[model samples]
Target: MSLRHTLLAAVAAVAMTGLAASAQAKTEITWWHAMGGELGKKVEEIAANFNKSQDQYELKAIYKGNYTETMTAAIAAFRAGQQPDIVQVFEVGTATMMAAKGAVYPVYKLMNDSGLKWDPNAFLPAVVGYYTDTDGNMLSMPFNSSTPVLYYNKDAFEKAGLDPNSPPKTWQELAADSKKIIDSGAATCGFTTGWQSWVQIENFSAWHNIPIGTKSNGFGGLDTQLTINSPLDVRHIGDMAAWQKDGIFKYGGRRSDSAPLFYSGECAMYMNSSGSYAGVKGNAKFAFGVGMLPYYDDVKGAPQNSIIGGATLWVLQGHDKAEYKGVAAFFNYLSSPEVQADWHQFSGYLPITQAAYELTKKQGFYEKNPGTDVAVKQITLNKPTENSKGLRFGNFVQIRDIINEELENIWAGKKSAKQGLDDAVKRGNELLRQFEADNS
Candidate 1:
C-alpha cells in the first residue's frame, strides 16, 4: 500500500518483461549430432559461429554419442514427441530414415518451403545422389561425407625396406608389402582395419566394382538380395583369413577399434574413413601416408571409386515455421563455401559443394596437407556406375553387425570363408526382407 512498495513491484514486472522479450527474440534450434571429441568441438564451433552471425536464431549443438546411438535417440525422441530440430544420421541409416515417411521434412522441400534459395546441383554428385530420393529430391543435407582411404606408417614402411612414398595399389602388392613389414622387425602385424562390414565388405565390393547384392546394391528398389557370397568375395575373405593366420592381418576389433593398432604402431597400415584424418593426425606419433583402397589386381573394373560413410543433417518434422526458417538459414550457413571448406580442411570431411572444394584447392589446402586430396580424387576417379556410386540397403546397421560377426568367424578359423559369407548372406537377407515388409 506504500509508495516504495508500488515502485518495487513495477521494477520486478519490468525485469520479467525484459527476460521474456529476450527469450522470444531468437528461436532456438537444437541440433543432435554424433561427432565426439575434436570433431564435437568443431560442431560446437560451427553452431556458435552461426548463432553469432545471426540475430534471429540460437543454434544449439548437442553430442549424442556415436552414429547408431544418435540416430536411435532421434527416432525415440520423435516417437515421444520431443525430437530435436535437426538430427545427424549416418549414411548406413539412409534407408531406415527414408522409410520413416512423416518423421522427416525432406531437406529439399524444407528449403523450398522456407523460401531459401537452394540449388541441389551445387553439391557434388556423389554426395547429393546418396541423400536424394528416387524422385531426385534431396532428403537430407550432406554434412560430413567421407570415403575409405589407406593409411600407412611411413617410418614402418621405410624400416621394412618398402617405399615410403609408394603405397600398395593392388591387393597382391598389399599382401606382399604387409608380409615384408611383418616378417621384418617393423611391426607386430602388417595391417588392421576398422568397420569390417564397411571397409572389408561394402567398400571392397565398390572399389572392385562388384555388387554386394542384386538390384544395384539396393539402390533401385526394396526388392533386393545379398550377393556377398560371390566367388570374388569368398576369395577375398579367404585371403584375409589366411593373412590373419600368417600374422599379416589382425582383427583389431569392430568399428574403429582397429584404429589404435595403426596409431600405436603395432600395425603398419590401416584402412578407415577419410574423416578419421583429424584423429590420426592427432594421435599418430610416426609419419603417415595416405593412399587409395587396395583392390585385387586381376579383377576387372578394380580400383573403382570408394563410397562415403559419414553422417548427414536431416530436418526433422514437427517444428514451427519460425523454427523451420531458422533451420534453413543454418543449413545455408553450413553450406557456404567458406564454412564447408573450413570443415573439410579441419575435420577431413569432404566439402559437400563443388565451390567448397574449389575454395579449398585455391587456398592450397590440399598441397599443404599432402595426401588429404586422396579421398576426393578417389571418390571422383571415374563416373559412378550403379555398383560404385553407393549402397542403399535397408536395416544396414543390423546387416553390418551380421557381416562383422560372419567376418570374425572366418578370421578366427571357426568357419571357412565360403561358409561364413554364405551364412552372413542368409542372415542379412532375412533382415532385408523384414525391412521391405515393414517399410512397404
Candidate 2:
C-alpha cells in the first residue's frame, strides 16, 4: 500500500477510538440524602452497584444531614442554582415540595421525559399515595418507606412476668404491661417513643380511624383545618400524660432520642419507625421483639394501617437532559426487585414495590425473621382509608415543632393534654393559613 494511504488509515482509527471513548463517558447524577450510619452505607452501596452495572451513568450519593437538614440544604442549593439532581424528602415534607412547583421535576414526568417505562401501580398503594399528587401522579420515587411499630425488650418482658412472645396489642394492654415492667424493675421505665408528632399524634389519629384534619388531612385542598384536638385526640394524649405522671411512660426527647432508651435496656418498650430494626438488632444487647403498634381497642375501626414515615427521592428541576437521563436510569435500578428486596432486608425499611415484597416472602425472609414482617403487615393489613393513607398538612415542619412544644408541656405537667393539643391545633392553623397565603 502507498505510505499516504497507510498514514491516513492510522489517523482515522485513532480518531474513531477517541470518539468512542467520549461517547462512553458517564453522566454524573448527584443525590443528596439524609441517611447516616448503616443506612448511609447502603445508599453508597446502591449507588456503587448502579454505577458498576452501567457505563452511561454514575450516581454520586451525598449525605447532607438528617431529614430536615437535608431538605433545607436542597432548598438552599436550588435557590443558589447548584441543586443536586435528586434530593430525598421525608413524607412530612410532601406538601411543601408540592407547593414548590417550579423547583421540583415530578418523578412521573422525569421518567416519562427520559423515555423510561414507569408504572405507579407497581408500588405499594400506601407507600405511593403519600408522595402522589391529587391527580394520582407520583411526585417522587418512594425510598426507605417505613411505619411505626412496637419494639420491646423480650428479656424485660420475661423479667416482668409478661409473655415475651405475645407483645401488647392494645393501648390498655400496653399500659398494663408497661406498669408491670416498671413495678417489677425489669427496666428503668415502661415505654418511650420517637418522632412524637409522627408516632403519637399523626399515626395515632390514623390508627384510630379519626381525621387529623378536615379535607382528608389536607389532601383535598390547601385550606384544610386541624381536627387533631378532637375528643379522641384529647383522650389519648391525656392518657399518655397520666402514664408519664405515673412514671409508667417516660417522655424521651423528640425524634429517635428514645431509641437509646430502649436499646440500652433503660426503657422496656419503645415505639419508633420499623426502619430502626437494623439499629436495634446491631446495638441492643438483650433479646427483643417487634409487634404491631398498639391501639385503643375501644375506638371504632381501630388498628388501621399505620402511615409511612420514610422519605422519597425527588428529582429537582433545571438539570440537563443527560443528567436527568442518568437520574431516571439510577431510579429504575434502585426500584428493581433485587435491589429493593436487599434494601428492605438490610435497612429494615418496607419494600417500595409489590414485587420486592413478594420476592422477600418467597425467599422466606419473614419465616427466618419472625418479627421482621410486623411493619409490612401493619402497613398493608387493610385497604387504606383516607385517614390511614397518610397526611399532607402544609408547613408540617413548623407544625410538627408546634405540636412537639405542646406535647412537652403536657409531659412536664404544665398543661393538660386537652389544653396542650387544643393550643397546638389553634397555633398550627395559623401556620397553615400562612402557608396557604404564601403558596397560593
Candidate 3:
C-alpha cells in the first residue's frame, strides 16, 4: 500500500472511535424525592419514561423517606457537598428553600439558562404561587400539588338516613349530619382529619378568606405575624373542640394518620389531601364519595380557593452544566400535557398546569370519574385572594408541629380553643422571628 493510503486509513479509524465515544457519553441526573409505596413506583415509571425517550440523558430517582426527611437529607447533603441534582421539597419548605440563597437553582432561571421553553403563566396560579418569590418568578417546579377535600363513605351516609349524593356543604350542615351519623351508629366517629394544622387552620383560614397572618400569610415579607387567633378562627376551632368532646369530631394523629379511619369505616367523614384518593380507592371495602371541603355559610367571601398541599421539584446548586441541561429536559418532559395529565390522574394529585387540566377534561376523565374534579374546582373556583393563595411562613415545618401540639391540647380538653390557638400563634411567631433572623 502507498504511504498516503496508510495515513488515510489511520485517520478514519480515529474518527470512528470519536463517534463511538460521543454516542456513549450521556449525562446522569439525580433526583431525590419523598414519594413512597405506589406513588414511588409511579415516580420511578416517570423517570424510566424520560430515560427511554432520549439517549443523551438518564434520570436516577431516589426515595429519601417522607417529605421532612427528604428535605432534611437534601440540606444536609448540600452542606456536605453531596447534594442531589434535584430535590422534592414539600410546600411547607418553600420558604426555607427560598431563603437558602446559595443552595437552590431557581426553576425559572434554570430553565431559561438551559434555553428550555418555559411559561410561568401556563401553571395553575394557586399551585405555583406557593413557590414563587415576591418578584413572581417560580422558584421550584410544581410536581404533585393537591388541596384538601371531604371524603365520605356512601354506605355510611345511607345507613345514617342521609342522602348519599348530597354531602355536607356548610359547617352547620356538617355538624348536623355528623350527629346523625353517630347517633345512628353508622360509624364509630362522625369525622376525622389528617394534618390538623394544615386542614383545620391554614387551609381553613384560606377557604374562609381570612388572613392567617398579617402580611398576606408571609408572602409579603418574613416579618409577618400570625393573625390566626381572630374571632372566626376561634369560633371554628372552638366548635371543633366542642365537637371532640361530644364525640362528633375525632382527632386522629397528624399528617395522614387518620386516613385509615375513613378507609376502615371507623369514621364516617374524613378531611385530607386530595392525594388520598388513591389510598382510599385501593383500600376501601365499601363505596365512597368525594366532596368539596365544608365551610361556614355566613362568612363573607367564604368558600374561597383552598391552598395546595403537595411538594415541588427544586433544582439544587453545585451540579454540572450537563446535569442541569438534563434536569431542564426532564422538567420540560414532565410539564408536557400528556405526562402531567397522566401523573395527575394516576396519583390523584391536582394537575398543576392549565393545559394538563384542560386535557384531562377534554379526554372526559372528569365525566367518567364524577367527583374527581372537586379538588380542581375548589382550588380554581375564584381568583385567589391574599388569604387564599397559600402560606409561606419561615421554619414552617416546626411551626406546624407547634400548632399541632396546641391543637392536641384543645382536643384533649386541656386548653380552650381560644387559648390553644393564641398560644400557637405566640409560639409560632417566635420561630418565625428566629427563622427571619437566621436567614436574614
Maximum-lDDT candidate: 3
- lDDT by residue (tens digit), candidate 1, 303-343: 77888888899988998999999999999999999999999
lDDT (10s digit) by residue, model 2, range 291-394: 99999998989988889988999989998899998998888989999999999998889999999999999999999987899998898888888888898988
- Whole-model lDDT per candidate: 0.91, 0.91, 0.92
Candidate 3 lands at a TM-score of 0.95
For all predicted structures, in order, the TM-scores are 0.92, 0.93, 0.95
Instruction: Please report the TM-score between candidate 1 and the true structure.
Output: 0.92
On a 0 to 100 scale, what is the lDDT of residue 276 in model 2? 83
Output the lDDT of residue 32, model 1: 98
Clashes by residue pair, model 3 = none
Q: After superposition, how far is residue 67 of candidate 2 from its true place, in Å?
A: 2.2
Clashing pairs in 1: none
- Measured with C-alpha atoms, the lDDT of residue 160 in candidate 2 is 93
**Best by TM-score, which number?**
3
What's the CA RMSD of model 2 in angstroms?
A: 2.7
